[model samples]
Target chain A: MATMTIAKAITSGLRAVLADDPKTLIMGEDIGKLGGVYRVTEGLQAEFGADRVVDTPLAESGILGTAIGLSFRGYRPICEIQFDGFVFPAFNQITTQLAKIRSRSSGMLSAPVVIRIPYGGGIGSIEHHSESPEALFAHTAGLRIITPSNPHDAYWMTQQAVACQDPVIIFEPKRRYWLKGEVDTESAGRDAFSAQVVREGTDVTIVAYGPLVPVALAAAEAAQEDGNSVEVIDLRSISPIDFDTVTASVEKTGRLIVTHEAPTFGGIGGEIAARVAERAFLSMEAPVLRVGGFHMPYPLAKVEEQYLPDIDRLLEALDRSLAY
Target chain B: MGAEHLPASEFDIEELEQSLVTSDPADAPPLVQLMAPDGSLREDTKYGHYAAHLDGEALRAMYRDMALVRRFDQEATALQRQGQLLLWPPLLGQEAAQIGSGTALQAQDYVFPTYREHGVALTRGLELSKVLRLFRGVSNGGWDPRESNFHLYTLVLAAQSLHAVGYAMGVQRDGDDAVTVAYFGDGASSEGDVHESMVFAASNQSPVVFFCQNNHWAISVPTEVQSRIPLSNRASGYGFPGVRVDGNDVVAVHAVTRWALERARSGKGPVLIEAFTYRMSAHTTADDPTKYRELAEEEKWRERDPLLRLERYLRSTNTAGQDFFDQIAAEADKLAASTRADVLAMEAPDFEDHFANVYAEPHPLIREELEWHRQYQAGFAEETAGQAEGEAR
Candidate 1:
């Protein structure tokens, strides 16, 4: 086990997949020579050569559309959309084509493609850079949407996503790229679609994903001080969410507070809340409260923190649930 | 008199037809056509190389493919009205255009289609029930492309053209003789991807056939809005051969598509075939053509219907008898009934089925979510049990 930043873990994960499969190729704008804008793909071009580590044109749609073509031709392509906002150009390819290709073909063609996007606000980024479009991909059928909260899961999940037969949308929290954690490369389990309970408690269950996992952990830690034991679950897979861990935690805690940086309306949080309400009605101490951004679009950088759900807001929601 | 009317100088129909058959640059006016609209063959046509490829059986099969597709299309439209389907894109008048090109391909070839290519999909062996799922709102895609070598129906206009070009590039990489055909409408010709596809196909010398069905109207938007010149001429600018075929003429479509596919297979790059077809029905079950266009224009096109033209040709040649026509009609009716039954009987996909294919490996979050749903559903069962006990008390 070694301590590494999320970027390093992702680099290592990509390296592992490349080493494992000769057919695996990574393509994106600046991903080959510059090692990606965030350098997550650093050293891959040199190690894999130009053919495998391709530097595509500046078109997001072109990148994804070509990736689909490549996938159809028996190559597993891991495409990186430079940033969250930039993914929209490729949205048609990803949602209309990549997502539906497998089911559309009635399982004849499997688009074992991974679309990696650096998402969420809080790095003080401009417009289009900070938006969360997970809900859009999740809403579409035949696409698996997942995000890693830390370096360890990032390392394991990225490899698992590459190996998966279906197209996987892997959203890495851009702001959390620098955050470091001990990644047990040897013991990093290869579970691709399940949720994990990071910190266990009994009073309330706090569900978060991607960038908001650390915030939820912090909120849980703070809630512990006030004699409230909060169980925090990291939703690694956003779509087809691992509801078992969530429901078990909710059943034990009897209260739930879901959090995310994306808007509350039609968010993955709403799906979790609705599911929990139906499943754990008797066990719930209070209605599932969601700690998320406003229904409006992601705000300006100055007020992004206010718009995003943080430890304070999450803890407050926990307090309200405890009061009930 | 209206925006629809253009001066005589804008388009010379005779000159365009003459240009279609021959490669003589001096005599070839920008477009290519080998057959006249009145079912007359043109002299000085460049399609001699492909004339031997079409036989009696092949021609009849192409006609049968079109007729069967038209019947299924009418059934689908009726189904939409009956509320069995959410919507249906009627390819009513464009049968000859699709079947001509669709039947021209080898079994190993790939086709990237826009949503309304029901004729093409049928030729590729896609079951009618599978196509129904997409319109029934039960599934996004009705069939797999790999099995039949046909790509899924792309709904986002001309995006499939780029996909086809990319696939053709892959075909070139594999050193394969298989070609790819991209089917789209004139409205799709306006999209950036279509232009990009042409450029890429030309630059790469990729084996692709860009078959554009100029069905006149793209929803409420007419062909005039999509292009200033004919759609076929746009390919010349991209450094490839472009031809405008009488889309209603099955013979023209077959000859042109066969030539294009053969050219692609032999590494001559891409060829654009603009089939001058007309949309005989509304764009979809939801669209009202009367609201946007004049009814008189539709009636005029109705007289030159592709099916009728083919039937006339078949009868004049003494090729199709009453028994053969009746047999095809019966087959079409049987197919429609079975398709409707199969579609209506399709069970709603299992909720857990959603989690199965998201990833090849089990995702931790999805596992938890499935468990959560199970527990949640169990709670409902517990409530039902409690309700039963309460009634007993």
Candidate 2:
């Protein structure tokens, strides 16, 4: 076990994959010398050489398009989209090409490309840098979308994403990059697609993922003081959501609140809420609630704290579920 | 007409810019032609040597490929008209551009073709009948790309350009000599993906050939709307050589494509070859060319028909006798019959197959949905059985 930040763990994981497979390559804008804008890939170019770690032309479509091609040649390419909002330039390539190639070709072709994006707002940055677009990707069928809340999962998930045959999008929580935790390098406790109960309780169930996992845990701790035993579940993968874990937890708690950094309307939370209502309706003591951003766009950084879902918003939802 | 609104001067900046954009077919760039439209072999200093090695048998084979693909194309169009297929994109006038470049590729070379490259598909050794599976609505993709080193046809224009470059980059990484060919039309040239594809290919020095079959029209839009200058001229801006060839001349397209492929394979960087041809038929079965184009223009293009010119060359050169032509005609008829038979016999795959190929990994939702579908299908079978039993009683 080693203590490291989520960013460091991802970097370490990438290095290990590069060393293990000569066919693995890392490509992105400013990723080589600059070590990525957030320094997630710092010192990687030096260790792996420029061929393995490439600084591509500043075009997202090119990065993804070429990544698709490289996969055809039997090389696994990991692309880094600088920010969540900036990924739009490559949206056509992703939603149309990468996501459909396998099914379009009827399993004849597989693109094992990993697209890493630093998502969600908390750094008080400018526009385009602080947006959570996980729902948009999760809506696409062929892609496997995963997010790591801590160093342990980040380490293993990064490696697992490369190994998977399907193209994967890893929505790295920019706000949690520096959060330190012990990562067991030897073992990955669970598969990349499954959800895990980070904290166990019984009164209310808080289902969160990516940037909101820590917020859910904090809300659970506060609810404990209020004599509420809240269970917090961290959803690792967003697309093929591990509903079994969420349903099992809801069966025990009889109350559920789904939260995320994206807006509530047409968000991942709504999908989870709808599914849980169907699966665990008999055990439900209260209506399933969603706590997330507003329907509007991610606002200016000065007032983003109000737009983002934090511990207070989660607690308010918990209170409503308990009162019902 | 008002004096001020009358016109700009001939040498005015606006007039000069307008002159750069030509709708006139006569104002095309210099072309490399090994076989002239009059059925005679023309001499070219730079590219002539590439075609010099073509023996009588090689020439005859090229003619055979062009004729067979044209026949297959006619059959597919007929199938669409007969309601046997949903849609078909005719490669009527652009046969030489597809066959010439396609036949030039080595077995190891990869091809990324646009949706209308039926001739290219034929040259790549694809089961010509499988191409109809897409039009027949039986499958999204008809054949395995790995078996032929030919990618599935890209419907979204210019999207495959990037894939071709990326594949070439992979070849470079693997230290292999194989080059990749990406085929697109003049309309696809306007896409941003093409710009990025060229930039990456240039920067990486990837071994890729961007073969743009300039079929004059991208549906209703002309080549003039896509670019002010010749499409090949755009390559010079991207730090690579571009060549314009007589697309109707099979020998020229073959020679030019061979030269470009060799240049790319030798690590000389990417090259762009613009095969200036014409779309002799409607874009697809769904399109109406009479609504958008003039008959006189079609007549002018008919004079330079690729098949006719090749036949003229073969007869004039005494490379093929009347017997060879008669045999080829008979073969085309047989091929057309088989293609029609094959398309009519195609069966739709199992419904569960749709859910199965969505993801390479074991996705829970796909699994659950597939399981539900199985149960739902079984329930219907049980109901039918019960109904039959009740009727017997």
Candidate 3:
């Protein structure tokens, strides 16, 4: 076991996959030589050579489109969108082509590609750099979206995303990139898609993913001082959400609150609330509430605290659910 | 070029094999014209070298292929009108463009085509009936693209250019030296995907041929509106060679496409061939060309019909006789009739197929949706049972 930051874990995961498969290639703007904006891919270009760790031109559509083409040639291409906001330039290719090729060809073709993007808010600086756009990709039909909250998952899930036969998008939690945790590098890795209940409780259940996982755990610990029990479930898989574990938790807790860094309006929380309500209707003690950012573009760093969801908001949401 | 850009492929997926069926060649560019509308041979030294493979028998076969595909297109259109198909995109006047370019490809090559590549599908040996399953509403796409190396028709404009480029890049990596063709129309040049696909293709030196059939109309929009200049000229801007060919002339199209494909397969980077052709038919069965275009314009194009010039040349040279023409006509009719029967008899797939392949692996959401559908379908039996009990009461 080794203590490492989430960024280092992700870099290790990328390194593992590159070593495992010669067909695997990494391409994105500044991913090579510069080692990515976050330096998550640092030292990779030198280790793997420029051919495997490629620095692509600045076209997001071209990155994805050519990646899809490379996938056609039996090359497992991992495409990195330099930032979350920049993914929009390639949105048409992602939605229309990347998401449909497998079904469009009637099972004759498979686009084995992975798209990696540093997503979510906190480090706030630029116009479009910090945003949680997972909902947009989750809504797309032919994609699997995953977000890892800590170093261990960042390590394992990155490898799993590369190993998946279907197209996958790994939305790395940008805020949690520097956070350190113990990573068991020897383990084969857990099922990357399942939701893990990080804490046990009976009064209420707070579900979150990616950057929000640690926040939810803190909320649970804070609630303990108030003599109220709270459960925290980390959603590893974003698109095909692990509702099996979530529903079981809701059945036991009888109350739920979904949280994320994305705006609550049409966010992934809505999908979770609706599904939990449908599947665990009889077990519900109250309407499943949500804690998320305000309905606006990610704010600048100065006031980002007011816009982001923190422990106070999670506690407020928890109190409302328990009061019912 | 910007840092984000690579030198793009020529023409935005807009190569069509040549001969524009226009009586007014006065406005047409000096393309690699091998056959004049007056039933005489007119060739250039460079292009003539490329088409040397077109002996009398080969020329006759090209004529037959064009004729048969045209007939198949007509039958499919008729089926759409008869409510057997959802819609049909007819490749009426652009037959020479599709047939010539498609025939120029080897079976090992991959093709990414726009929806109107019925003739290309024919060249790749896809059963015409199977191609109609998409139009017939029974399947998402009718044929296995890998089996024939012909990808499913891309309805969206210029989207396939990137796929073709990436596939070509793959072929380059594998050292297979196989060609990949991306087919689109003049209007598709405006798409951002096309821009990026070209850049990626050129940057990687991928073996792709951008075959843009400038059929002069994108739905109701004219080709002139899409570009102020000829589409082929756009290739030079991307730092690749582009050529204009008479799309109405099969020989010119075959020769140009052969040269382009050869250059690509030889690792000489990409080529863009603009077959400046005309779309004689409406965009699809749903369109009314008379609403936007002039019948007089149609009449003018009809005077320089692709089949007419070829037939005239064949007759003048005695390359084929009445017996051969009669035999081909009969064969075309036989194939169309059988295809009609097959389309008519095609069954709607078992409902299970819908949920089965949503993912290569089993998915919970799909399985749940499938169960819901099954229950919905089974509700009728429960209602029938309830009705019987009520009647007995």
Q: Which lDDT tens digits does candidate 3 get at residues A1-324?
A: 999999999999999999999989899999988999999889999999877888876799888888888897799999999889999988887888888877877677888789999988888577788898999888988888889988999999999988887889999998889999999998836778789999999989999999889889999999999999998999989977889999999999999999998999998999999999899999999999989988877898888888888999999988888888
The full ranking of all candidates by lDDT, starting with the best, is 2, 3, 1
Per-residue lDDT of candidate 2, residues A199-279 (tens digit): 999999999998889999999999999999999999999988999999999999999999998999999989998999889
DockQ of each: 0.22, 0.46, 0.55
Better of 2 and 3 by DockQ: 3
Q: Relative to the true interface, what fraction of contacts does candidate 1 keep?
A: 0.39
What TM-score fits each model?
Answer: 0.78, 0.96, 0.94
Provide the lowest-lDDT 10-residue window in model 3 chain B.
B1-10
**Residue B115 CA displacement from its true place in model 3, Å:** 0.5
User: Roughly what TM-score does model 1 have, to 2 decimal places?
Assistant: 0.78
Q: TM-score for the second chain in candidate 2?
A: 0.92
Clashing pairs in 2: none
Q: In order, what lDDT does every prediction score?
A: 0.83, 0.92, 0.87
Of 1 and 3, the candidate ahead on lDDT is 3
- The top-ranked prediction according to TM-score is 2
Distance from true location, Cα of A74 in model 1, Å: 3.9
TM-score of chain B of each: 0.88, 0.92, 0.91
